[model samples]
Target: MICKHRRYLMYISQNYSYAILRPIQKYILSQGGEVCWFLEGDEVDSSYLLTQETKLKTVKEVVDWKPDAVFVPGNTVPRFIPGVKVAVFHGFDSGKRSSKRGHFNIRGCFDLYCTQGPATTKPFQYLATKYGYFDVVETGWPTLDPLFEDNASNPYVDDNDKRPVILMCSTFSQSLSCAPTLFNKVKELSEKGRWRWLVQFHPKMPLEIVEKYKSLQNDNLQFIETDNVLPLLQMADVMLCDTSSVLIMFLLLGKPVVSFRNQSPSSYLIDVVDPSKIEGSIEKALTKPLEIESAINDYSKQVHPYQDGKSSARVVVATNELIENGLTNKRRKPLNLIRNFKLRKALKYWGC
Candidate 1:
């Protein structure tokens, strides 16, 4: 049971999502709130960067803790939990219409949403208006707080390596992915040794594609697969992307980005629609990364304006308000009962 003076907040981490939610966990502790973790996989244990006292391994342990609020970075939260479930979204709302995005379905699982900014809040607000379920709070993305902080540094960047570092990232979709399209071009470019290269991809990328890139790993080029890309964003001199939202987040650093077939290319992006032009674009981005700083700053304001590293604090406060108000704030029924029922069943099959 939650104490009258100090509330308890439970968070679930699935591999890399631990990176996104750790800041909120720290903030909750600072605010005199007790925190616990609900690990997504059996392989996860207390020894994995957390103490046994703070990590609850089983569903029964989570139930006994009786949290005042629960935060989920992924889409679904368990069916019947003690606390209010808050959907701390996993990725950017890139406006991509994919089956994975849950595009229009309000799953009725989350009591509240901690949105990134105005761009992300609009659609959720419209859903709240229509279904009268869930609250949308613009708390920025807590994971990004360190990026905007004065002391945040990337330990990976080597000053001795004179070559410009080029970072490549891609989404995992045929329609929007640049992975297949730019593979040969990137391999050819990396071979030249004109630049140091880093490759990161969406965790959902197909195994075949992953192996294809793994074969190309070499001395000047490295492949990274981690939940946290913020440090990578800090270290790289220039970024090459397709439609992934990380490109939008990278712009916050005021660095240059080259996009291949970005659906809605921003004025700040160095857009290269043709795969043939990627090599040339990377050279240009490396030459003058900050030339479009003014435009990138304007774009950053639209996504997340605050640089004070307090987004996690705002999310905690908003979540606590919902805890105090109780379930009266969330809609009991989903907008589409049949669809939500199916989704819930699928979630059960996955042990979510």
Candidate 2:
């Protein structure tokens, strides 16, 4: 399909959006399309913008550029922006919260939702039918393209160290996070120098907890703070996580995940209640037992079956299709006056 989306805008509000949108940007550039970024809010660092990348300093600049579509990794986008708003999503549904507040929450700011897989697509499709405003397309997730790409080098991988790498990730939510609970056990295990531990927490994780983990870094363990967690995910033999959606990302690699008190544990995860059992669970995951491996494969298929590094292409195509067809058949998006007003106040764009 010939993509008419020659000019696209990346709407970023958080640091993680950079990793999610960069692959899509790469695909657009290769297709001879132009992509510019419009960074909003304080959470997103302007320094993350590459020298080669173009940034529209103000909402006026974005309006003047007239992008065909605006790709948003966050929940909401400015509807006033002149483009078809596409929700690419920030992360998989980790089931940490109810559908009303979590991943399935529709704020009516998007024209289309490019879902990751069947698991998400079905629900979004149902919502589309019910709401009659936004369209749903299963284009996988562009953020994971690097994870599936061949010939990709992992800088974290050490040739000399043959020990299995365990990536530990946690959500930032005070109620759902396991970082605090597992800190003591992790510290004990890292000191043992049996397995290499890589600890990464959500950007919004509390400073005190993050510091505690950072202090535990030694020859056996490392605390990584990066925009891209793909390398760590690739290098790790097994993942140790809680309710963080990152475990879903790790599971897509067909690796085992040992979640600590997961909100909703299934056959896919070896869920442990006590911190003391973390090591045993890790060992079990490393073994890649037939039952758990089969479950992981099944869950991976439901969440993200696409192992090919071409989800970006599909996203571009989906956006182009939406732009060309228009939303004439669907009902208009809700006014969303309050949210839009807040966004306008934030961006200082009062233009009608």
Which candidate should be chosen as best, given lDDT against the real structure?
A: 2
Question: Model 1: how far is 131 from its true place, Å?
Answer: 1.6
Per-residue lDDT tens digits of candidate 2, residues 273-307?
99889989888888899999899899889899998
| Top-scoring candidate (TM-score) | 2
Tens-digit per-residue lDDT, 1-352, candidate 1: 2223554545554555777888887887766677777776443333545653377666667777778788888766665556878887777766566533454357767788888877768877887777776888889988888887654456667768988889999999889999998899889988988889999998778878888888889978898877678888888889999888788778888888999999778778888888889888887877765557778888778777877899988888888777766544445645455655564464343232
lDDT of 1 at 164: 84
Query: Model 1: runs farther than 4 Å from truth?
Result: 1-13, 41-53, 98-105, 150-153, 289-291, 327-352
Q: Rate the local accuracy (lDDT) of all candidates.
A: 0.76, 0.91
